[model samples]
Target: MSGSLELGHHSSLHQAQDSSKCLDEDGRTKRTGTVWTASAHIITAVIGSGVLSLAWAIAQLGWVAGPIVMLLFAVITYYTSTLLADCYRYGDPITGRRNYDYMATVQSYLAGGIKFKFCGFIQYANLFGVAIGYTIASSISMMAIQKANCYHKQGHNSPCHISGNFYTITYGVMQIFLSQIPDFDEIWWLSIVAAIMSFTYSGIGLGLGIAAVVGKCLQLHTCIANPFLVFTDHFASETENKGLKGSLTGISIGHVTQSQKIWQTLQALGNIAFAYSFAMILIEIQDTIKAPPPSEAEVMKKASLLSTLVTTVFYMFCGCMGYGAFGDDAPGNLLTGFGFYEPYWLLDIANAAIVVHLVGAYQVFCQPLFSFIEKCSAKACPASPFITSEIAIPLGSNRCYKLNLFRLVWRSVFVVTTTVISMLLPFFNDVVGLLGAIAFWPLTVYFPVEMYIEQNRIPTWSIKWLCLQTLSVTCCVVSLSAAVGSIAGIINDLKAYEPFKSSY
Candidate 1:
C-alpha cells in the first residue's frame, strides 16, 4: 500500500515536471502558439458581456457621471487587484501555485478547519458561478442575434425570441465534444483564432453601427449639443422623484465636490469589481504558468500591469466610441436587435461573433467545474475500482458490482441535482447583485479586515500612518453602506417588476 502511494505521488510529480517543461518552452518561443501573453488574456477576459452593457449602464448614470465613474472605478480596481496580487506574493513561498490555490492554502494554514474550508468554498463558488453566468450571457447574446437574423430573413418587424432550453442543450453538447479533444497545446491556437475573429467581428460591426448613428446625429441641427454638458439640463427633470434629486442638487452646487463624486466613483468601482473576474482568471491559470517560484512575482506584476492596461484601453475605447456614435440610442451590446435592420454584412459579423463568444464561454465555465468534481472524486476514492476489488474481495466475488453501482448512482445524483438548480435558478445580474452584496461584505471588506488584524499582531504605526488608517477605515465603512444601499435598490427594482399573480 505504501509502495502504491509512493508510485502515485511520483507519477503526479512527473506530470507536473513535464507540464513545467512545456510551459518553459512555450514561454520562450513567441511563435509557439501555446503561450498567451498576459495582455491578450486580459483583453479577452475584460471584453466579455461588460462591453455590451457598458453603454446602457453608463446611460443610466448619465453622460457626465458615466465616464468619470469608469475612470474612478478603473483606479479602484487596479488598487484592489494589486492588493490581491500582493497577498498572493506574500502567501506562497517557492511553490508555483496560482493565487486562487495559494489563497486557499494560505487561509487553511493560517486559520485552519472551517475558516479554510469556507474560504476555499466561496472562492470556488464565485469562480464557477461567474464562469457559468458568462457562458449563459454569451449564449443569450448568440440567441438574440440568431432570432434577429431570422426576423430579418422573414421580413418581420417584430422582435425575435429564442428558446433558452435549446441554447442550454446545444451549448452542453458542444462542451462535451470539446472536452474530448486531447491536446492542451492545440487549444491556444484555437483561442488565438477565436480572438482574432472576435476582435474583427466586434470591431467592424461596432464601427459601422456607430457610423450610421453618428451620420444620423450629424444630420440633425442639434450637432453642437454635447451630451456630457446637457447632464444638468436633463438630470433634474429625469431624476426629480427617483431619489437622486438631493445628490444632483449638491453636484450642481460644486463641480468637484468629493462627496457628490464618491457615489458615482464607487458605481464605477463596482464596474471594476464586475470586471475583476479577469484577475480571477489569471489566478485560475496560475498552476499552468512555467516560471520558477522566485520569478513568479515579476511575472505576475508584468502580467497584471499589461492585462490592466489592455483591458482599460479596450473599455475606454468601447465606452467613448459607443457613446459618441449612438448617444442615447446606442444599445449596450453593440449587436442590438434594433441595429440589425441597418445592413446585412454588419449583422452577419455580429451574429458570428456572438456564436463564437458563447462557445468559448461554455468551455471556460465547464472546465473548472469538471476539474473540481474530478479532484473531489479522486480524493474520496484514490484506488481504481478494479484494483480495490481485486485486493479486498475474495477471488471471483461479485461484490465489486455493488460498489460500482453505488459509485454510478452517487455521481448521477450529484450531476442531476447540480443541473436542476443551475437550470432553474440561474442567477444573472440582479440576482447576482443580491448574492454579491451578501457575500461581498463578508468576503471582500470584512474578511480582509479580519485577516489583517489576525495576521498582524503588532502595532508599529506612527501618528501620521495611524490617521491615514483611520481615514481608510472610514472610507471602507462608507463604501460598505453604499454597497448595501445599492443592493436594496436592486431588490426594490425587482419587486416593482414582479408579476401580479405568484404561483407560490
Candidate 2:
C-alpha cells in the first residue's frame, strides 16, 4: 500500500505545491465546477423520495401538526448542518482527514485503531444502506406508475396486484444498467432534467387533484367533509394501544398522552428522518469544499444559513398544502395520494416525474459509497493489472481510473444483494423506519458527535459547560436507543411473513 495517505500528518510544501499544480492543470480547483451555490444544493438535497411520504406522515398527525413538525425538523437539521460546517471550516488541512472519514481518523487519535475501524465500518454501512433504500424507493415509484396505468386501461376498480419483489427486481436491473454507463459529468445534467420533470409532472398532478376534489365537494356540498378535521376527532377519540404508547413513553418534550397527539407526533417525527438524511448528505460534502480564507468561510456560512431557512419554508409550505389536500390516510406515495382525486393524465405525469427524480437522487446518494470503495481499492491495490489495462490506459485516463475493477465489481454485487434482501422483505413504512434506524440514524447522529469530540482538541471546560456536554451526550444516547428499538420492531414485523420461504 502507498504510504501517501498518512493520517494527521500535514502535507509538505512541496507536496502541497504539486497538488495545487495538478488541480490547476486539471481545472478542477476552480469555483466554476463546484456546485456549492446555496439554493441549488439545498433544492437538490431536499427533493428526494422522502417527499412522497411526507404528507402521509403528516396525515397521521392532525392537519395543523404536519407543517409545524416539518418546520421544526428543518430548523433542527439546519442547526446540525451548521455545527458540522463549523467543524469543517475550522478543521486542519490533511488529505482524507476531513468529513465522515475524518471521524475515523479522529477516533484513532482519541481512542485507537480498533475503535476507528469499527466506527468507519458502521458509517460506511449506513451509507450503503441508504443507497439501497433509494434504489428500492425508485423501483417502487416505477411500480406504482405501472399499476396506475394498468388500472386506467382495465377500468378495474380493484387494487393493483404488483408486489415488492417485482419492484425490487426491476430497480436492481435499472441500477445495474445505469451504473455501467461511464462519465460522472453527465450526472449534473441528468439531475437538472429530473428536477424539471418532477416540477412539471407534480405541478400538473396537483392542479388536477385540486380541481377534482373541489368539484366533488361542490356537487355533494351537504355531505362534503374536511378530512383533516374529521380525522382529528376520530384519532382523538380512539384509544392508544399499549405498544404504541410504550414506544413513545419516554422523552423530554413532545411526549404524547392522547392517541391523536401520539399519532401526530409520530407523523411529524417520521419526516424528521428525511430531514436528517439530507443533513447527512451535506456533511459528506464538507470534505470536498475548498478551504476558503477566513473571510470566505464566513461568507459561505451566511449563504448556508440563508439557504437552510429557504428550504425550511419550502418544506413547511409543501407539507402543509399536501396534508390539506389528502388529509389522513394520504397514500404512502404522495403522487398516488393526489392521484386518488386527480385526473389520469396528471397521475401519469406525476408518476413519471417521481421515477425520474428518484433515479437522480439515488445516484447522488451512492456517490460517497463509491468514493469509499474507490479509496479502499486505491490503498489495497494501487496498480491492479486488470484496471491499469482496461481503465487507466485509456486516452483521457486519470490516476483515479487505476481503482481496482475487482473492488468495483464487488461493491456492485454487495449493493445488488442487499437490495434484493430489502425487496424480499416489506416495503413502505417498515422499510423506511428500518433503514433510518439501523443505518441512517447512527451515521447521521451518533457518529457525528463521536467524531467531533475525537477530532477537535477542545480546551478544558467549565463545570457548567461540562454539564451541558453531558446533557447533549445523554440526548444522543436516548435518540439512538429509540431509533434502535424502532428498527427492531420493523424487523420483527417483516419476519412475521413467510411469503418466500427458503428463498434466502
User: Going through the candidates in order, what is the number of backbone clashes in each?
Assistant: 2, 1
163-231 per-residue lDDT for model 1 (tens digits): 555554455556545653323343666566556656765575445534543443433447437553232
lDDT of 2: 0.52
Off by over 4 Å in 1: 1-36, 89-105, 151-156, 159-162, 176-194, 197-209, 216-272, 284-295, 324-332, 337-340, 383-504
- Compared with the true structure, all predictions reach lDDT values of 0.48, 0.52
- Ten contiguous residues with the weakest lDDT in model 1: 239-248
The lowest-lDDT stretch of 10 consecutive residues in candidate 2 is 239-248
